[model samples]
Target chain A: MNKNFNFCIVDDDDIYQFAIKKTIESLNLTQKIIAFSDGEEALNFMIENLNNDEELPDVILLDINMPIMDGFQFMEEYIQIKPKLGKKITIYMVSSSVDQTDIDRANRISDVSDYIIKPIKPGKIKSIIEKLSMQEN
Target chain B: MKVNTNSEITAILATNNDGIVYQFNTDAETLLGYSSKEIIGLEKAPFFLIEEEFNNFRKDIANRYKENLDSDPYKLLAKYNGYDSREWTIIKKDGSRFVGHSTLTPLKNEHGENTGFLRIIKNITNQKETENELLRKNQVLNAAEKISMMGHWQLDTIADSVKWSSNLFNIFEVDTNQALRFETYFNFVHPEDKAIVSASFDKSIKDKVFYDLLHRIKSTSGKTKTVQLLGEVLTDNAGNVIEIIGTCQDVTQQRMAEIKFKGLLESAPDAMVIVNDSGKIQLVNKQAEKLFGYRSQELINKPVELLIPDKYKHTSHRENFFSMPKTRKMGEEGDDLYGLNKNGIEIPIQISLSPLKTEEGLLVSAAIRDITIQKIAEKKIIEAKNSLEILANKLTIQNTQLADFAQITSHNLRAPVSNLNSLLDFYNIAETEDEKVILFEKFEIVINHLTETLNTLIKALKTKNETVKNIETIMFDDVLIKTKEILSGQILKTGAKITTDFSQSPHIEYNKFYLESIFLNLLSNAIKYKSEERAPEIFIQSVIEEGVQKLMFKDNGLGINLKRHGHKIFGLNKVFHRHPDAKGVGLFMTKTQIESLGGNITVESEVNIGSSFNINFNK
Candidate 1:
């Protein structure tokens, strides 16, 4: 696992956040992990540090049901600054909702690679990374 | 044997069989609508007149063979369905319908026994119409008299005597009530006019001159009516007038609405024309000339129908106006109809039809207003509405596109993640018993997560992408029967009581397949999620509101907490309670199917109480 490849998670539920964090560690997916309680904080933090060469996360798990600046709104703003950051970044949508509307919205964004329902685990995380590698080649 | 002529005896001196000149009569010819020549000289009666074809007026023949002629033939004519009866009908020479009277009687020889028959006939058509009119006049008198031709009166002298005309009674609707008398005359003259009438009469009587005046009278019923009285005193050679004779007419309604009608013509925000019944322009204001390109003086004598389109000219005949009887029914005016313009261009107009009685009779004065600008304004409104509809459609399309994107992303991404997680967790399970339990938990968690993602997709589609399908009149019992058949054994096991009543009639406009799904899903859920207290009781009935038909299915099963999960009840796999089979998918699918068929579902429920779903379908 590369420590430089930081993972960022934005989810409102503490239980979901804890589970994703535990799965990341158990799979040896990455060494560094950062979490935000809501979409607004995550988006703000990412924009403020967008200029920093190593500040951007390699992967993001964006939750749909955040209180302010929902995942869709964050994606709209975040996509504008993607080239400026000069980094390989992928966003995977995460939510407890099984609503197709949210899934379809996530699929429409090029930067969003996939969607995952709550309680993400090691095996699911590995498959996402593998798919990303395949696409990059 | 000629009953009235010695010459006929000379002719029997001419022919045989008693030369029955006895039958000769003037009316007998007229009664059959035929000539006396056909009846008198003919040996055989026309079979058309006799009900018994070959019998040849046989009963009359038998009586004639016995001979007695003095009996009145008219009553017998009616009895034998003869040509001279009081109630007579004729068969025309062309075999068409006719009206006539017929009679029959016996002719006797010197022995005083019956020998031959004599028949007398009369045609009564001329009197029929007069009596029929008498009948109609009795039925509704307002229709009997032409209400448009009104009249007025004036008493030229002071009064021990007075005068009246036909129309004064018409205005009072008195022609129908009682016999007209000099007192009936006083009953119609306005009370205020009474004093004026007396004063004017005294003045006129002293001078022996005529009186012309307008006055109001309180009719016998105390209703005030306006009347114009115009007449002179009729006198003997002494110049002392014997009595006052005059025309009294009601002008109440016209006197009130005339000023408004004139004002409406000039300042009427629109044009107007008043045309007499003969189709000549009686009056036209400035606005009308401006609209039609002709001065009122120029158009005055021209036919009013000239302003109407050629297509409508055929419809503007006086006969059309005369078709409906002239009745006293007021306020339900004739259509504010159409007319042509001077330029021969048809312009939309709102007309008011009123009757004016000149010496000529009723004239229809049309108060017309042009609606061209109003039509233009309506077109503008329609254009705006069309643009707004386009905008709404655009937004709906965008919304649908976004929903599709969400559904695809959620469904596509979850599979790989769940499989990888389960595979890794499975390896850990074999290492130790504690690890095995942990691995099983991990596997369950990943699978549940995957299931929820799939469910979200289904739920979103249910709410958004459901499209309408075939619509038909779906019978309630048939749908229920199909549902019961599908879940027949399950229902038997659960022992759920499902009572149905169509007594109020639940058949409505709906798709058969969708309606079937609606009942199936609901009943299945009721049995699947039964409240454990006792056997479930489900009530199903049809309801209607404002022409919309609804089917209500209420179950006494474990109900949902509407306050918490109300909005998401039909969401995919969003299970309300922890039942093993609580996938929450049934409601989502059911809702989709129902909505696709242009129907709706609404739920009202309380936690652990009961739930009732009312489904309304398009009619």
Candidate 2:
């Protein structure tokens, strides 16, 4: 796995965040994992580090249910500032909702790479990492 | 008297003074239809007449000459009279009598003394018969003229005189005794028609041909009548016009009837086509001309099939209709009839047919009405109904989906199962007691969340299933008072000011528990989401909208960002505010309660300004 890659975890649930971070650490996928309690916190960090390549994540796991701002709201704001970022950011919608409406809505957004129902498996995380590494190659 | 022998007299006869047979000329024999050998000197004048007429004539002679009266009146008249003239009925050989005028004269000798008389008679029967025939013919002609409202006239061009029959004077309403001239007839012609009539008459005289014209005449009675003048010029052998004889017929009433019929035909609302028995178009109204896009003259004398579409041209029903015609509506049910316009465009039409009885024969009149608009309107109505059904089906599907979503939430098994799987994976790979313990703690938190979600889903499902059976007439003021009481602690802590107006619609028929819960949830939500920049000011009002009772809850609070969260505002576990007490189940349950009773809830909000929730209660 590429250790130079940065990953973002945006969720209100701390347990889901811990699990995702621990899984990334266990797989040795990256040491630069950044965590946000909600989409709003993640969006604030991205906007502040628009040109900071080292601080911005290459990949983001976004949760639909949050306190301040949800995944869909973050995507709306992210689209407006995405052109100013120095690197491409891959976003995956992660939620416990099995509702087709939510899934369809997430798929319809061009910025969302995919939708992963919680809780994501280690194999799924490993495939995501492998796919990113292949793209870089 | 000596009888003068002359051929000028058609017939003659002479008798002596003794009243015996004397002389009968050949001319008299021929006039009397007798042979000269049978009557000349063989019979006396009395022998040629019937005894009844002869005796009456003799008595009349005796009375006329009383001084010479004797036993024989003829002999006495013959002796005394110098001359006398009388009409005698002479019997013919064939037993037919003839009327003859005879003269009797006294024959004088050279010594100037009275002698035997000579009777000279001539037959004037033919002349008298002709006179009586002419009189009869004149009377018949007068009667004919009066009955037909026609009069005859003779213009003697050579004499420059005009003679009008008695009926002509009557037609002009003029005295018959007055002498009428050509100028008198010309003056009766209407001023507008005077020049034309005069020119026609002059043309006839110059060309020596027949003249036939229809013109308006203003009679002496101040009545205008349409008259037809038909005449022929009488020409001599040398080709010189001698006279002009004509008859004038009053055609005013006939013309008026024709005009009235035309007006009725044109005034009909539908296109009227009058066809003869041979299927030929005889007459068409203005509407028919306009509908078929053809001129009146173009359709007349043409086959009626020209207006029918080609598809129906060969239908035997058309021929059957003519064979046994009657008043009936055309086109059977589910059979569409169309008309072909002059431009060959097919147009939908409805037709009604009726038979017209006329002098020539029975004619069929078809009334055609265009139904293009009706067809289009029917199509539009069907299309609209189909679209409305489709929309209704979509709504039903969405409702089913909502139910399925509620079931899924109540199960709340997906997240817990996935979390347990992840935790088990972590425990299996932990290799350390601390790591396994950390994973176990996380499992507890996941279980708690699952249980909380399931409980909230159950409450929502209960609100949805409680269908409106507990409906009661609840007062808005009472509900507001109770809600205020329940939220008194928060209101005091936040210094929330609440105002209400329920005068317009103070009460509504709704479930009491649901209504109270709605009131409490909306009131607390307003205070809980209040903006810190100002004190909370909440306004509650009840009003009737579109015959439905509605409660409006408005507050000065940190309003929701509808653009981002509008679609999921009423969803279970959907939260927008960061308040510690925000559980996100209050509005969802409120919506469930409203929708379950066939009511609805809508919101209008601005960030950091205010939010208004409108709830319409079921009637």
- Candidate lDDT scores, in order, read 0.64, 0.82
Ten contiguous residues minimizing lDDT sum, candidate 1 chain A:
A11-20
Error of 1 at B305 (Å): 21
Clash pairs detected, candidate 2? B1-B106, B1-B107
The residue-by-residue lDDT of candidate 2 on B197-292, one tens digit each, is 989988888888967999999999899989889998998999999998989888888878877988888999999999887889999999999999
Error of 1 at B568 (Å): 1.4
Model 1 clash number:
49
Q: Model 1 TM-score?
A: 0.37
Measured against the native two-chain assembly using Cα atoms, what DockQ does each of the candidate structures obtain, in the order listed? 0.05, 0.21
**Given candidate 1, what's the lDDT at residue B147?**
64
lDDT of 1 by residue, B445-469 (tens): 6567666766756665654565655
lDDT of 1: 0.64
CAPRI-wise, candidate 2 is: incorrect
Docking class of 1: incorrect
